[model samples]
Target: MFDRKEMMEAFLCEANEELQKLEIEILALEQSGDSETSIKRIFRVAHTLKGSSAAMGFDEMKTLTHEMENVLDGIRQGRLRVSTELVNVLFACLDALNALRDDIEAEREAQTPTDRIVERLRAIGSGEAGAGGSAAGSGEPGHQGEGGGQAPFEVGEQDAAAIKQAEREGMQAYECLVKLADTCEMRLVRYYVVAERFNSGGQVIATIPELHMDLDVPELRFLVVSGLGEAELKAKIEQIMDVSKVSVARYALTEAPSSEPQIAVAAAAPEVRQAPGAAPVKEQEQKRSSQTIRVGVDRIENMMNLVGELVIDQTRITQLGHLLRDRYPVDENLEMLEQVANHFTRVIGELQESVMKTRMLPIGQLFNRFPRMMRDLSQNLNKDIHLIMEGEETELDRTVIEEIGDPLIHLLRNAIDHGIESKEARLASGKPLVGTVRMTAAHQENQVVLTVEDDGAGIDPERIKQSAVRKGLLTQQAADALTEQECIELVFMPGFSTASTISDVSGRGVGMDIVRNHIEKLNGLIDVQTKPGQGTTFIIKLPLTLAILRGLLVNLGPSTFALPMGSVVEIVRYSTRDIYTLKGQPVVKNRERVIPLLWLHDHFNLPRRKRTRDHVFVVVVGVAEKRIGLIVDELIGNQEIVVKSVGSYIGKIEGVSGATILGDGSVALILDVTGIFQLAGTPKKIGSAPDAE
Candidate 1:
């Protein structure tokens, strides 16, 4: 019943976790030179990955991890030191491991080459390159531990006590020396298998170099407290492949053998022991593991679909109850039906919320990936930049998290390449030598607002205007007429970039526009705020979840449409007298801001309804700084609507993002606020205008 596919998937998952931790710890180690804790963590992660890869028969991954483990072990034992070059080599190893993991996940085998990285790791581990600090102990495996002359298999007080307690329980303590074949390529893996065999029969008190230490030597010694006699233990060790010789001798507590050269104790036993009255860590871990299980994303999506169906049905039942009450006025069951509908509505609402919550994940998952990227970028650009992140605990829908990573990455790259000044320039400008780019996420009502701000040379509006004109994106007159904010907005224009030269990082003029498009596709908003000399901040606002949303349904002639409430700033009943022409376009004045008015009937090519009253309802919708007041014939009440994609048969509509089913079973197109703005074109003027109503 061995499930190879399932085992590979589990290995892939575990590898990803370990690799992420290694990257974080490696960066920390570089920051705080000679951090023992970070070194140990890095060593542990590499060792875990080495063991897992070996078990899965991924030779490439196992080899790479084994070399990485050696290098990390060297650093941990203080035989090697951390340096910039050493850190870069470690990062290279990490990148190789990631590629290997990706290959295994996709092709069921690691196709990435690890020979070069392994050589580099070996070079560093042997003190040949990029390695500093004392070059103690011949760099060979099983050399006496730090500050030589202590016994290699020496047991600590706690381990000796455990051995004595096991002896009292009728178990015999024995010293087992297992020697590997001279041609054994994976000595560590072979040792691991031997250790597992010992632990299966009885407890392994300890090992000579310890499990995580250097295991490249020909021989490994294990202190075992087992009920199995010497013959049984020797037979067990002989069964393992690549194990050349096995010798088991009864251990005497009184004497230190003079025949064997004494070596220092490397590390304590790997087994964790708990204090009195405390729950065992292994038991607690098992309890925790039992509490949670990995459920696939597809299952969650299916559940969400089912919830959407329930919501639709619930809406239908409530509508049916309203009809029953209104038409059949004092029927006996109408009251009960009404009560049941109300209760069902409550339950469905709760269910919808719960399902959406299941889809929610903290934004930190996305934010944590940026620091390492920032580090590499800063180094590449030769700029002194510090990236500060905040509000990572803010939660967003998993779907949103998946989509937002690319946009944020583009912004960070632009921040480093275009916004942040170089060290010399910063000094000349009287700013700090190290530029800081801060990324923060927070919950703003029903939306998640993320901002990436950089204290570099704030984007120059004049330069943007000039670039726009030079690139033929705009006429000189047009560019000159645009205000500073509008000039900055020009960056999002297709094929628009302010960089004088194109490079690998950016400057081909293909990033910002795509960033904006991706955000809009999620029904989100991205805006930029900049000052001349201070900094620039790109703010993105996205919905908490896309599966369900509160939508404002409106009537345009005989057709109904849903405007996402996230984009709907406010609804205003404007008097015909309040609407006037500003440069031949119908405009409305709301709170001193002039917003262009659009007729949905004209946009959708439907017949316009004549105004029968002096006032009109305008649903003001906006994304970022742009606002357009959409004129509707009638205002339908808001409701929770399930979003459904329009099938490919109908293709993509211009202003309609998607469609949602109503209580009456009719489909209403969900209006895309960003698309509507595009269809509306750029507004001409926003100044005071004469009322021509």
Candidate 2:
């Protein structure tokens, strides 16, 4: 209630982060049967999200999280074990939470329809969730916890109602005594797990002081409540992973542990979830001081940029030392300079690596939402769609994460509307009724490649051809010459889409071109490949960060320019006699093919000096299918340049992507080889329209 607006925004950020953690835990838990800690971890996340959602006044979020909490409560109580189907459902729940969270953050003022979801959740809680079961049916096998060696509790009516209210306003006061079982794996983790379990149902009231370090007899103790009867609660507790036993006890004013689950702890203040302990709250006050601290990304980016400039300057200084050494040869002082320069290079290289790492954010930030997105979209379309995500640990520059969000959403919408088939269609196609879309990420050289692939009906070449002609992307004659793959790629052309009916989401190519544009702005590329009836896949390759481009510097028309070394095969010297004119175009033969050549003087409109030299530097470059030679005056060696975009308007200048200031303060434009090649009608991947994969 303290500054409601601020609290809402803070809650949104916290929930967003927690939701991401929840998704990773769920995926990890699904892959391992031994992952009890992971399972408990996911439950705790759901519990945290539930509290935050209710606090933020998101009714839809609150409702879904509430049910999600219940399912988690069942897991905590040991009423159910995770199954493949269960994980899918949990992912769906997480997906919903994510979308609701998104809408809130965007200030979209949108509400999701979740009435049926509530009914479904209720059924899940009552043991009637799957097909024909009902809440009134017999409980799951191994769900009972009436004996010792179990931290068990059952969900009774009174406890259920109390837990609900507690969730709405935060949990009321309670105390717990936790004793670690002999079978416990990772005691500290279990202690965390124990603490998390209590907090999930309701916040932790208090724990025995000096217990973790002291390991005293009362060393193992925790106090918690969820508004459910102790027996119902104990039933759930005893079933936790690695838990040898569980006992739900009440705490007296004297900090005594009550043996029976039949008793109730009196409620205290609004935020208080535990009864008053002998120790003050300060004793337990976030002992680790592990709280979130926010810093503007732009500031870090600025700092990183400055560091990059230092590297370039450092390199320049070493070059200066080399220049001085040549003139004043063979001296002990010059030898020492050489040694010092080498060390500087080593240190700077490491420093650059460290800075790059600081900019990396996990792809999990985005993957966390797909589970929820797939669920809602699938249900709305009356199809069964499975989203398989891989390489969730893949990292990207923070800026890439933020910029790529909208584009990824667009692709997901495309997969749902254009890639996936309905249940009936899938069944008729001799495929499983449940279609699948797999989103994967992997590191390829200095680039991060993300792919979105579907198993539904692939793009039809004829369909794309017709659509292209309809949208005027190509003339009928042009469309006629396009192979199936070529036709599918046309979907990326502006104003191209095949959907005759439009929904709130997709059917227009608003997002595809944008996806391509943004990726290119990051010096990335996108490619699309489809099978006539198999499905479509979009592959995107992006640089590690926009802050730097690994470039090979070369002299162009009395000035220097950086060509990304990642694409350069080699630099070969071509004598003027070896160069010939092919149909009025300058060409050079290197290895096999006659490479189309661009003269630095003519391309940049710079005055050319008389050719006193015997050779022209051939900067051999390739991007996708394009292999061309940039005829330059001299090669200036390779260096990683901190890429800085030239300001607006001029940025629109074809073939020049960005610029970086060199050691001597002169700015060199970074050549967009892909852009230049495309302009010169060379075969190469350009922008978002990727070559087929």
The CA lDDT at 281 in model 2 is 50
Tens digits of per-residue lDDT, candidate 2, 1-693, equal 469778876687577667667776786776674255675566556656766677666778777877876765565555555666667777777667767777887788746667776777777776776622232332643323332212222222344455445544533334444556675556666666767766666655445342364343322445555655566666655666666666666532211121111112133333323333323455544431232335445666776877887888886888788788888887788888888889888988888787777677777666776776776687678788878999988988878877887788889888988888887787788998888899999999888899999987888888878877877778999888777666767776777778888887687557787877787777777888778679989888888788877899888657888988777877888777787767556677888888877654555677555566677677888765458887667788888788887898674767888899887778999988767665556323211110110
| Top candidate by lDDT | 1
lDDT of 2 at 587: 76
Q: Model 2: C-alpha RMSD to truth?
A: 12.9
Stretches off by above 4 angstroms in model 1 are 132-202, 205-290, 682-693
Question: lDDT scores for all predictions?
Answer: 0.82, 0.69
Name the lDDT of candidate 2: 0.69
Please identify model 2 stretches exceeding 4 Å from their true place.
1-13, 21-43, 46-133, 136-143, 146-299, 421-429, 460-463, 477-488, 575-595, 600-603, 613-615, 649-651, 682-693
User: Estimated TM-score per prediction?
Assistant: 0.81, 0.67
| lDDT for each residue of candidate 1 in 498-575, tens digit (9 for 90 to 100) | 887889899898999999999988989889999878899999999898889999999988999999988888999988
